[model samples]
Structures are given as structure tokens and as C-alpha cells.
Target: METRYDFVIVGSGVSGGYLAGLLVKSGAKCLLLEAGKSLNPKSFPLSPMDLHTQSSWGGGVEFSRQGNLSLYRAKCLGGGSVVSQALVDRVDNEILEDWAEITEVEAFKPSNFSNYYDTVEAVLRPYEIPRDAWNRNAEIYLKGFEREEYYWKPVKRAAHDCQDSAKSSDCIVCLGGCPRDSKYNSLTRSILPAIQAGLEVQSEVEVQTFQEKQDHVEISARDKNGALTHYQTHHLVLAAGSFGTTEILLRSGLKKYLPALGTNVSCHPQFVSFGMFEEIVDAHRMAFSAVTSNDSKLRRLGVKMDSIGIDPVFVSMLLPGARKSLLKNLAHYRNLASISVSLRDESNGNLSLDRSGRLQFDKPTAPKDRHRIQQGLNLSRNFLLAAGAKSLLPKTQIFGLYLAGGCSLGTDLKTSVVSPQFKLHGSQRVSVTDASLFPSAPGTYPSLTIMATTQLAYEHLRKPV
Candidate 1:
């Protein structure tokens, strides 16, 4: 007989980690399943000096499907949080309003989630961006936002002892797997607490499918050898980001119940703004996404600014193939600097299970979404100019790690994958508690917003204390 759990969570990132923590604390029987391998803090490589191309954080990924693109995400243990910019920007009020308007649902107000935001901030120790934390490149961009009256707030970062990391863009490891263990990925903080609370957390178990049977879900998964593994749960939660979550649903044939499961996906189109300066900036000497342009400016122009660390891989992105030639720039690596402008993209894309149940990008970028990218480009260029950048161009597509949205939610069941209450409409036992549920993508960093709303989701489904 397969052992059963009261709740089985798919994915162990922010939503899963936080939700698991909550459920476990409240005495709920929970089983958290992540598609990726588990990572232990002690065994983690935290320094950029110890990283390589296949590093878990920014290292390459192996897509489960054939003909599907393998994008980079920290697949080990912590998920993308293992190697993502520890940014904690909240959803702008206007954007939140826009989300409700489009979703045609109520209750995603900024104020409503204020306390939730405060709670997460306190736990993560999201620090304020000191003025000194700004690299020359970031400072120049900050000045531009100031002059333009774009609602720029110094971004909050999720970490402790990040001062040194902030000084140099060398915080690359945090994006791939912090070499210094400075970042506070959700697994270390949230999931760990859940485990301490006696929650049974299993790793290396990849969930392939699940079924609804009256009052429970029969989840089928695999062991490391691809052997069949099974889990039973009275309730289910899918926080597997947007991409991973929807893939499981489709493979389980649950996508048939909701026509819009793979539609309305969004990702920020990010590109770097490089500058040739008289001095070595070596911005990569520390943290990433510490300083950011104001949300107002970001929303109007459709792009947000993130302070960056100037490292070699980053150097590779900034001036591709300029490694050996960078001795001249190295003298100015301390002076040379750059910023990443992630556009709040309007274009919605799609992810589908190809015939083999593997994920594939349908390339269904509508004209409006295309237009949003253009707007972001124009705004990014102008922002760079404002920052006194001598050169500016986008530098990515290798990993194609733009924030993609899937399994979107709204009040209209026909148009969205879930309802406004954050419940998977067609599935009685499932709920989507990740970034995939956003109606219109927030016009800036989305970590805080996703978490805040996730808290609301738990509140919605939580059994009374």
C-alpha cells in the first residue's frame, strides 16, 4: 500500500516552501515533491570562484521533453530560488488594480497583502539598498529614474550579510547557487522549518502525474532509476512555478478540464546595458538586483532596473568574447558597469505538452506582446542614455530564462487556468500558488507579490485553526 499524505505539494520554491511551512506548522500532514534534485546547504558551492557553466544556479538545465528547450533553473533542491536574484520588489498598486481588472476577480489589493509582505520581509531579512551599494553603472541609472520621476524605490533584497556582495557583482553564485551562502533561498528558511515541524519532506522524487478520486489525489512519480513511485494525498497544491506546475497537470490529462491552462503566460524580456567607462567598475564584485528603478518609471516604460554584480560570466554577457581583451577593461572593470532592464512584458505566450508530455514553447507571441517588447526596448535604451551609458544592447537568449508565465488564473473559468481565489477551477483538490496565476504580469520584480498572494492562497484553503 502506498503511503498517503494529507497534502502533497508539487515544487519547493517560494510558494511551495512558504506554504509547506505554514501547513506543517498548523499540524497538517504534508508531502512536498520537487521535480529537481535536492540540495543541502553544507554541500552547496557558494562562491562564484567555484562555479561552472553547468552550475545549478545559472547552470544549464535538461528539459524533460524532446524538441523542448532546456532552460536554466537551479533544479537542485531549492529550485530557481537557489540561483535567482534575491529581489523582493512588491507589486505596484496600479498593476495590482490592473490584475483585478483583467482577471475580473476581487481581493488582490496591495494593502490587503501589506501584512503578508511585512511578514515575509521580516523572515527573509530583506535589507534596504544602501546608497553605497550602488555601483557606478547602477548609480547612473538611479539618477536617471530620479530625474524622470519614475516611481523608483530602492529594491529590497532577500539575504543577510550581503554588504560585501552588494559592493561587487560577484554575487553570481547566488543566481546559480551562492558560493558564500549569503542568500536566503526559501528552501533554507521556509521548507527547513516545515521539516523541523515534523513534515515529511522527500527529495529526488519526480512527480509525473496525479489523479482525483472522490476526496483524495493519487499521485504517480518516479525514483532516480525512473522506477514508479506513488503518493496519496487528501489535498494537493501545485506551486511548481508556472512552467513545471502546468506540465504535470497536462501530463495527468487535467489540462483537458481547463482550456486556458497553457495560455496567458508572461516573461520579462531582460537585456543588459553595458557602459565603457574611464575606470574599472568591477560591479560584479558583489550582489545582484539590490538597487532598482522605481516601479512607476518601470511600468510607464515597461522595464525595471536591477543593480548587477560584474563577474566573468556577466562580463561574458556584457562584452561577449572580450575576455582576454579585458585587461584594458579590467583596469576599468572596477570602473566599467552595467544594469539589467527587465521589461514588464504584455505579450502572453504558451507552453504545451508535445505528443510525449514534454514541455514545448508554442512560439505563440501575439502582436500585442510583441509590441510590449518593443516598448520595453525603447524605454531601456532611453534609460541607458539617461545613465550616461556609451553602449547598450540586450545580452541573453542562451538560457532563455525570461520569467515565463503559465497556468494563469482569473474569475472566468473559460479564460484562465484557475479562479480569482487561487483555486484550480476544474480540479477539486488542486490550487496553483505560483507566479503563473498573475493576470497581467507585474511591471517589475515579482517575488514579493507572488509570495504575498501565495499567503492569501493558503489562507483561502487553510483548514481553520
Candidate 2:
């Protein structure tokens, strides 16, 4: 086992991938330990149906369970960037101000953070949806919002030459993985650069715990064959998303000392609403989540409405509970256009390990949060009706997509896990630079914001402690 390195990062997701690249460029010996196997960019899924098939490198999904709330996330090298729709939005000014105040960190100020944001944007190369790529489903919302005089705009997405994905009839599989290598996932865009720069990566390694001393930290991980290996590094960074990082700390007994380790988890819980129109609407041929509402009224309520892409498999799952009408809903899938209304929930939850060491989510949508969801649903119905829909079916099932804030940053150690600089409380060499450091849930797409946070952490990582 490699016993010495300048830095060891857990999880090769957005933060870990980008940080590894930066560190390697600066001549640091870095090793990235990823739980999932590395995927080849050349073999990205060709069609939506290709997602379920096993590739040379394996990709899988894990679910966060509570009672009725189940959150699905990617368990792979590229993490959420691979499985997401690639909707890239920066942190809202309001969210930034909130972070600055909560953590008392000047870096969160919009002016100071602009440099990091610009750096991330340059790398991501996000762009608005082109006119030719606007499929019928996306257009439905655009036309409806225009008619209703509601604020709406084209969504910015991170991708390079996505024309093929946008033109394909089976493009709805984007949420699973982009086979064309158009989407700017970390594996192809960031981690590969780091690999070329001499950064070491070990896939299929599950880190179990960390033994931190004054000068170095030792990590114990189980490899694919269940063989445990101990690796040592001067610096340890955790970028394993919110739940994964929190679970690690909990398992390592950090939660006993820092009670805030697994609390204040927030998610953008969304409900999907379907509108059936007489005209045939092939929603899958466009970029998923092509446009969203920007109305101030909705923003105050922490609600955002965006167009959604649904393939046959997902559509079948969301079919009405009535068994008799299941086939009827399936038959109209082609003619139905869908929109998702997601709310930035105010009520935060907690993450805890079950008796078997499995991570469990205990966040329930608060009544106030549910009210905002209803507000979003009502607005969605109005927009769908404006699009000349013959009928509307709004599913009230709440599902969370963008997860954040399990190990949040704050000035108060009693309520937060990390400091404003992304350093874990009571530790010098340990830091976190992921969505888990978000002070609270930002009320929009958080992919870009999460990346930007790592940029901030990178700046601090260069300074001597």
C-alpha cells in the first residue's frame, strides 16, 4: 500500500476531481480513492436504455431511505455530475449572502466569490439551449410561461458539443448518463486531466475510517476483494457528497465529539406534474430541464418550476396508483409533457447510521415546505393549462434531487461541522470541500455552486496552517 502522499481525497466527484487536478498541477502528490469503478468516456451510453447494462467499468445507483422519502444518487467515479441532467446554475445572491452571514466568512461575499465562480464557469463551458435543440416538451413550458407573463428563461447546462444528445430521440436517458461524452462530467473532463498530470486514482475502494495524528492522517479502506489497506497522507480531504462524508465521520466516532456532524441535511424536493395535450409531444428529444421559472413570488416561497424529461421506465413508475388506468397512462406517455416543481425545503433533517452501519436519511418535508410545494404545483398546473393541455395529472410524491448541507459550515461549532474555510472543527489537516459544506440549501441548481466551493477550499488549501 502507498503509505505517503501530500494529499488523499475521498470520492472522485466534482469537488474531489477538480481539487485533484489543481493539486497535481501545483506539484503535489495526490491520490483519489473512489468507491465506484472508473468509467470509460468512449463507452458512454448510446441510448437511454443503455443505462441499465453493465459497462467495462461498473456504475450503480444508491438510495437514501427514511419513511416515504427516498433519494437516489449515483455511486460511480464521476458521482452526481455523471447521473444528473447537467443543469448548471450558480449560487443565488441570496444564498451567498446567507452563507456569508452564517459562517461569518468574507469569502462567501459575492464580490470575493466571483473569481472562483468565473474559474468554474470557464471549465464547465455552460451555455443556454440553442433554438434548434428546444424540443416540444421544453417549448410547452416556454410558451405557457410566456402566455402567463411569468418569468422564465433558458437553463444553462454544462456540456461540450451536445448536439447529438439533443437531436437523439432517446435523449431522456440523460439523467442516467450521457453516452456521447458531451456532458461535462468530472470523469472525462477533470479526473482525466489529473490522471494525465500524474495524480493516482484507486477505484472500488470504500474508506472505512480515518486515524488522525498531529502530522498525518491514516485511512483504512476495503478494496474490491474486501482486502483492507492503510494509506497515509499529510492532508485528508473528504468530498464524498453529503451523506457519504457524514457517514464516514459518524462511523469514525467524530459525531460523538462534533454533534453537528450529520445534522441539517437539506434537499431540493420536487414533484412532477404531467400535462396531456392533443398534439403529439416527444419530450425526450431536448435537453432535460431546459427552462425554469424565475418569478420573485415563487422565489420567496423557495419554489422553482422547471421542465422535466421522462422516459418510458420513469413514466411507468410515476403512473397513477389506480391499477385500472395504468395502461391508459402509459399509452398517453408520448402525448404528455411534464414539469417539475422543486422547493428549497426550510426544514432540515439528520443523517444517521442504522444498526448495520447503513446510512439513513431522516428528513421529512415540513408543513411549510409542503405548502411551498403546493404553491409550485398550482403554478405548474396553470402553466400546463396555458399550454393547451386537455388534462393535467400532478403527482404529489416528493422526491429530492440536489442534496446539500449535512456537514454544514457555520461560526457556531455546536450547530455546524466545518468552519467557513472548510476545515473540520478541532482538526487541522482535515477539511471538506463539497455540497456538505453548504450553509443551507441554495434554492436552485447547486452543481456549479458545489464546484465553486471546492475552488474556495483549494485557495485555502494552498496556505500553511
Candidate 3:
């Protein structure tokens, strides 16, 4: 095995892919690794009839601590960006300023990150949806909410070639992976560019642990053949998603020295309010995440809605789908369903591991947050009713465990696991650039933030390496 590399990046999702691109462009030798398969968007299916085993929800790794079943996520090359709703809202300038001030890291400048955001969006080819293409469900949602003068606005999404399909929802196959290839997965955009830069990214290579040594860090992983392989490097960047990064670190036994390491892991708690409409509200017509509510009241309530779709597995998971009445109710999926409420919750959660270094999550939400869930439920119920929904069965897809803060940045180690630039507590050449390094859970989607932070960290990496 090649025992040395100039830079080692763990996880090829948002952060890792972006950072790998930067390093490769800088002419640095870097190795990118992920514990997933590479998917071809062209291979995905087109209609609701296009699902089964190899399900995004089947045998997928889930990290919920709430006792709720694990939610589906990408175990593929592009990471969640391939499976995401593709919602890319900029970080609120106020939120950015506050985190930088608190962490004493002036580099969190909104302008710096904003430029990165624009670059990424242009690369992804983001665009809004046309009204006529909205799934019938989404159309009903618009009518119902509009009647109430609700302040919901069309959501900005990353997509292409939105062909109107009377048989398919706008983002009908979004979670299964975008069939139209309109969705931006890192494999095609970020990872491809990084690969073009001559950076090497190997799939099925799982990093086991790391040991700090003389002027270098030794890393080990299991290759495609399941044999242990070690790679040494002067620099290491961990852009693994929240769960992957935490699991790797906990396995490395570094969390013992870094107490705050896996403690406060959380994610955006999402709940779906099933609006069973009377018309074939083709909820799958527009891009996933095509609209969002502007009511700060819901924000104040800690509940929010975004453009979303419903396939049966998710429908079974998040809606009252198992109930016979709900099943009978769902028979009208052709005319039923509209929008999903992807809540940005303020719940505290934690990450833990077994002696074997296997990962787990556990976080019981408080009543306050629960109240917000109820409030949103009520609003969704009202809308579904207004839209002529016979019955609105609201369910939660999120385990209410939107994991965050595992390696927060702050002025002192007691308050954080890493510095503002994402250097770990006791290491110079090791850095974390993914969601795990987020100072807090971003109110909206995290892809853009992950990309920006990677740019910032890679700039630092380019300086010395």
C-alpha cells in the first residue's frame, strides 16, 4: 500500500469534495476516501413505480438517538447533495456575524462565503420551478396558503430540464436520486472537477483510525478487499458528514481528549403535514424544495415548510401511512399530498459509540420544541383542510435529531472541539471541514455552508502545504 500522501481527506460529500477540488487545483497531492458507492444519475428511475430494494431507506446507516427509525441519507459518491432537497439558501448574514464574533474567528465573513456560494450555485445550475409543472399537491398547497395570505415564497432549487410529467412529481425521484440529472450531486460537479485536478478519490475505502506521529499523522483504512491499509500524511482534512466524521473520531478514541467532541450532535428536525387534497396535486412536478413559508410566526414557533415530494417509503415513514384509514386516504395520492414541513428545531442531541467504535445518537426533545411541532401540525392541518383535504395526518420524517455542534468552534476548547479555522483541539495538520464543524445548526440547508467552509479551510491548507 502507498503509506504516504501529501493530504488525506475523509468523506467525499460536500465539504470533502470542495476541499479536494481546492487542494488538487493548488497542485497538492491529496487522497479522498468515502464509505459509499458512486451512482449514475442516468440509472435512476423516472416514476413512483421506480422503487424497491437498494432503497435509500433500506440498509442505510441512520444516526437518530430519538428511538425513531433511522432516516435515509446518501451512502453514495455525491453524498446527500445527491439525495438532498437541493435547497441552497445563503447563511443569514446576522447568523454568520454572530458565530464569528462568538468564536473569535473573523474569517466567517459573509462576503467571503457568499462568493463561494455563488460559484457553487452557478456550477450546480440552480433555477426556480414553473407553476404549471408543480405537482397537483403543490398547486393545492399554493391555493390554500395563498387564500390565507400566507407569506410563503417559492424556494430556490438546484435543477435542470424539468420536463412536465403528468405521471411524475417535479422532483419525483429526488430522494432516490434525481432521474433527470437536474439535481446536483457532487459526483458530477465537485468530485468530477477535483478528479479532473488529478486528486485521487477511492470509494469503498473506510478509514479506521489515525495516530499522531513525528511531524505526520498515520491513517489506516480497509480497502475494497477489506484488507487494512495505512496512509501517512503531513495534513488531514475531515469533511465527513456529521455522522461519518463523529464515528471516525470516536473510533480514533480522540473524543476522550476532546470532551465536547460528540456531545451536541443535532440536525434539522423535519415533520410532514399530510394534506390529502381532492385533486391530483402532482406534488412531484416542480423541484424538491420549490417553496417556503415566510411566516416568522412559524419560525418563532420553530416549525417551517419547504417544497417537498412523497414516495410511498417516505410516505409510509413520515405520514400516517401504516394506518388502514391513512392507506385508504393515500389511495388518492394522485390528488392528495402537498408540501413538507422541514423544521429547524432547537433541540439538543448527542452522539455516542460502542466499545467497537460503532456510532449511535440519542436526544429527547423538550416540550418547547414539541409544542412547536404541534403548532406546525395545526397549521398544516388547517391548510390541508382549506385545500379540501379529507384528513390531514401529520408525521415526522426527522427523528427530531438534527445533529450539530459535535466540533463547534469557539474561543476556548471547553466550549469547542476545534478552532475557528477547524483545526482540531490538539493537532496542527488535522482539520474538520464538514457539518460536524458547524458552530451551530444552520436554519436552512447546509450544502452551501459546507462548501464555503471548505474553501476557507483549503485556503489555509494551501498556505502551508
- Taken over the whole model, the C-alpha lDDT of each candidate is 0.67, 0.80, 0.69
Order of the predicted models by lDDT, top scorer first: 2, 3, 1
TM-score of 1: 0.86
lDDT of candidate 3 over 273-354, digit per residue (tens): 7665555665645544456777767666556676566676556655544678667756777665755665565666677796
Tens-digit per-residue lDDT, 199-289, candidate 1: 7777767788888888788889887688898878888888888777878888888767888888876666555555655555556654454
RMSD of each: 3.8, 2.3, 2.7
> Top model by lDDT, which number?
2
How would the candidate models be sorted by TM-score, starting from the highest?
2, 3, 1
What's the C-alpha lDDT at position 14 in model 1? 71
> Which candidate gets the maximum TM-score versus the true structure?
2
Worst 10 residues of 1 by lDDT: 61-70
Candidate 1 structure lDDT: 0.67
